[model samples]
Target: MEKRRIQIFDTSLRDGEQVPGCKLNAKEKVKIAKKLEELGVDVIEAGFPISSPGDYESVQEISKNISHTTVCALSRAMEKDIKIAGESLKYAKYPRIHTGIGTSNVHIRYKFNSTLDKIIDQSMEAVKYAKKFVEDVEFYAEDAGRTDNQFLSKICENVIKCGATVINIPDTTGCCLPEEYGKKIQFLMENVKGIHKVVISTHCHDDLGLSTANSLYGIINGAQQVECTINGIGERAGNTSLEEIVMIIKQNPHLNFFTNIKTQCFADISRLVSKYTGMKIPANKAIVGINAFSHSSGIHQDGVIKKKETYESINPKDVGVNDSSIILTARSGRAALKYRYQQIGYFLKKNSLDLVYSIFLKYADRKKEITDKDLETILEKANLIKNHSSRLSSDISRHVI
Candidate 1:
């Protein structure tokens, strides 16, 4: 089967920066953009030029430095916003103007306070005006997750007709389930008149903690591009995490899609964003998290000790992570304990394990984790006792401290 290639549009510098305290300086933004380019993103949505003067400079500086990835500037449907976006990317070799407005009735009525007809007209004008600046124009419909399927389809159709090279459907609120979001993409693929003229893209949020799932679903359905941020940092919960989305498609064969991302760079990118943004990644975060591949339970640890493939779905090396952690705790099995002991040069046999039980009890009483160093010290004392007279019996009964 032929695998479809999905364009990864990294929004780490733009939407990811919108998160509180995640604001990066122009220097930081340029630094990240260079890394994003090295990570092989198809496009880097640098910043919203009209949002602030700082944003404009950051986008411009990023555009000047980035050579391979297409530099994109976000803008509202207003002419001023699109103009600022174009001005910001004047030096970009491959520039794209990503401009759009809300297409959902809720946004049309409550947010924009305008009629649907006016919404379509304004969206078209934005795309057309943006075309004057750059050949690549991407149109986005915010809150596309909750938008009426038929109306959203029309917005995509007209946006493409107006010269949008790509149509971005954003689940801005992360409100939809995976199945519903998938169906929504399928609907756009089946209904939009001009859908074939432009690539369909997905920009899903993680408010409900399913951004990566929904984005993958979009790819599985029909979305040819995915808008994501490093470490999943963005407004609210976040946009689709670039690491999560990339790992998912790589690990799941059923998705039938591929991207150009350098998967091995995933960890470094996550760490860089987390450090710059000051938002520490959750230990349970997919792919790049510290505990993503950690095993502690007895059954799982035993399986992992037997073979890493038994417990881990993806290889740590693939995503630049060091290795799976075989954490030792009360739930750890003898096999894991033996494996850990061997790591410290202690090859304990069954009889030796019986002797070690008393030491284990003492160690468990005082500490939650029995470090190899601690185990070695305990054994060293035991070996001294064996030489003294008794065969390292619990006669001395020193605490496992």
Candidate 2:
């Protein structure tokens, strides 16, 4: 079966930068834009041009440097915001103007203190004005997660009629369950007129820790584009994670959804974003996390030692990680201990193994885990192993074979 391609619309620069204390300058923005281009994102939302002169310059600079990737600038429903966004992308080879307004009742009644009619009118006007400046215009209905499905359909229909190349339904507050969000997308696909004419995109937040799940469900329902940030950095709890979304689609071929992202660049891009943004990735975080492919349990280590597929769903090399780790901790089993010993060139016989295990538990209790050097010390004290460094060299050579 032919697979459907999902456009990865990365908002790391625009939305991701909204994380408190995680700001990037124009140079850094351009740097990340270049990497995103290399990573093969379909679109990079540069910044909100009308928000500040610095943002405008950053968008302009990113537009100037990015060649293949579409450089997108965000704007509000106002004319000034749309015009400034357009000017900021003058040098972009593939420029898109992303402009929209709040569509939820809460936003209309309280945020804007206006009626639904005015909000709909503002949305239509914004898309129409943006269409004049750029051929590729993406309209986002902020807080669409909480908007009424019927009213949201009307707003989407009007925006599409007004010339929006893409319609973004964002879970601005990160307040919807996966099933609810999926149903919302399905409703838009069925009820919105001209829905098939433009791409339906999903921009989800992780406030409820459902951003990735919500995005996946949106695709299954109808969305063809995913708006995500590297390492899930964004406002509040952050946006959908790019690595998680891409890996999910890749690992599950039956879904038949694909993105142009080079999966091998996952680790590199995650590290770069973490370094520049100063947000250290959690060790247990999925995909790019340090312990994503590590094992410590005895049963798990035995299974993995016999066959990696026993415990691992995805290979380490698939996402550019060098190798899977066999972490030796107090919880680890004898199988893991044996594997660690063999890895460093200490081969213990079954009779000697019980003795070594007894000593290992003592040391393990004293230390949080065992290291290669610790193993060597254990072997030396046992007086059963010789020439640790020479044996290690031979074991390394044997591994290469």
Candidate 3:
């Protein structure tokens, strides 16, 4: 079967920088935008141009600097916002105006102070207005996860008719489960008229920690584009981690979905975002975390040492890290000890390995972990090397006599 190419629409600069203290200046955003392009994202959502002068400049600057990747500017359903968004991307070779309105009843009434009919009218008008400035237009149905599927399908069909090249169904609050989100996308695929004429995209948040799952489910059901951030930085919890979803696609070839992302650049870009945003990556965070490829448990270390595939489904190098680690602690088994010995140029036989492991356990109990120097001391104290040396000398003397 032919693999489908999934467009990676990175919103790190716009949505990721939305975290209260994680804001980046125009220069900083351009730096990250260039890196995102180098990392092979299909589209970069530079900023919400109508939000502020800083954002407008960031989008304009990014659009000017980036030539290959499509640069996008976001806007609300308002005419003024869409006009500003269009102006921000005037310099972009490939530009898209992302404009939309809320679809769910909650947003229609509480957020917009309007009804669904009005919201649909606004959504269509927004797309039509955006199409004036650029050939590419993305219409987002904000909170579509909770919107009535039939109504959502009508909105998508109408927006496409209004000349939207892509329809973004965002799980704005991250409230829906994978099954629910998948069904919503599937419903659109089956119900929306002229669905095949435009790309269906996903924009999911991590409020419930299921953004990655939900996004992938949408792809499985029919979505062709995914909106994500570098380290899941965004409102409330965060958006989907770009590296996570990309790696998931890479590891699961059976799904026949692939992206243009340079997987090896994930770690570098992850650190760059973390450093600039001042958001620390958790130790257990998947893919690019410090402990993502580190092993400490006895059984786990043994399995990893024998065959990495036994314990790790994804190779550390595949995600840009240099290599995996075998952490030596009190719980480390004989296999770990043997591997550590070989690391320092000692190849212990099975008999000698057992002896050294006995000494290692006692030494490990008194200490937190055995470093290379500590292991060398343990090996010397075990007397196995001395015994072998003594036997060699005795054999030499016998032959000489």
Candidate 4:
């Protein structure tokens, strides 16, 4: 079967930077934008230009440097915001203006003090105005996760008719379950007029840790674009992780979904985002984490050492990692010990290994991890180094004779 290509719309420089204390300057934003283009992101959401002058400059800078991928600027459902966003993207070869308004009841009543009909009107106007500046216009229905499906369908259809090429359904609060989000997308696909004329995009948050799941479900239900950030950084809890969604679609061939993403650049971009943002990626983060491929359990290490596929579904090199690690811990067994020893050019006979294993256990119990230096110390303490050296000399002499 032909694989359906999912456009990866990266918002790392925009939404990802919304995390508290995680801000990037224009130069830093440009650096990341260039990297995102290299990583094969289909669209790069540069920034909300009306938010600040710094953001406008950043978006302009990214637009100037990025030529392959579409450079998108975010805007509210207001003429001023759309105008500024357009001005910021004047140099972009492929420019998109993302403008939208709240459609959910809570946003309609409290956020905007308006009614459903007015909200739809505002959404249509925003898309119409944004279309004047860029041929590619994406309209976002803020808080669409909680918006009534019927009303969501109405606004989405209206935006599409008003020249919007992409309709983004964002679970702004990150509250929707996978099934709920999937059904929501399905409802739009079945109900919205001209839905086939525009791409349905999924913009999910991770407040409930369901962003990635919801995005995948959205795709299964007909969403062709996924809005995500590197390492999942964003407002509040976060957004769908770009690496997670990309790797998921790549690994699951039966899903028949593919993207233009360079999977090998995951680790590099992940590190760059973390470094610029000063947010330390948890060692347990999926895909690019430091410990994602590290094996510490004796059974797991032994199995992985015997066959990589025994414990790991992904080849470390596929994500730019050199190899899987056999970490020496208290739970490690003889096989892991032997493998680690061999890695450092030490060849221990079964008897010598058995002897060293006993001593290693005692040392392991006292420390969280056993280093290569500790292994050498254990060999010396066991008096096996001298004996092994003598044996080596004897073998050399016999061979010479």
- Which candidate leads in TM-score? 4
Which residue runs does candidate 4 get wrong by more than 4 Å? Answer: 386-401
Across 185-221, the per-residue lDDT of candidate 4 in tens digits comes to: 9999999999999999999999999999999999999
Residue 194 Cα positional deviation in candidate 2, in Å, after optimal superposition: 0.8
Report the error of model 1 at residue 386, Å: 10
> Who wins the lDDT comparison?
4
The clash numbers for all candidates, in the given order, read 0, 0, 0, 0
Clashing residue pairs found in predicted model 3: none
lDDT of 2 by residue, 324-356 (tens): 999998888888988887786566667666777
Candidate 1 residues lying further than 4 Å off, grouped into runs, are 380-401
How would you encode candidate 1's per-residue C-alpha lDDT over 1-401 as one tens digit per residue? 89999899999988988887667999999998999999999999999999999999998999889888899999999999999999999999999999999988889999989998999999999999999999999999998998999888887888888899999989989999999999999999999887888898999998998898898889889889999999888998888989888888888777678889899998898898898889999999889889999998889999988899998999999999888988877777778877777775456767676676666657766788777667666676556344322344443333322
Which portions of model 3 show Cα errors greater than 4 Å? 349-359, 362-369, 376-401
For candidate 4, the 10 contiguous residues with the lowest summed lDDT are 392-401
RMSD of 3: 4.6
- lDDT value, residue 39 of candidate 2: 97
State the lDDT at 176 in candidate 1. 92
Model 2: CA > 4 A from native: 385-401
lDDT of 2: 0.91
lDDT values of the candidates? 0.87, 0.91, 0.90, 0.92
Query: lDDT of candidate 3 vs native?
Result: 0.90
Error of 3 at 193 (Å): 1.2
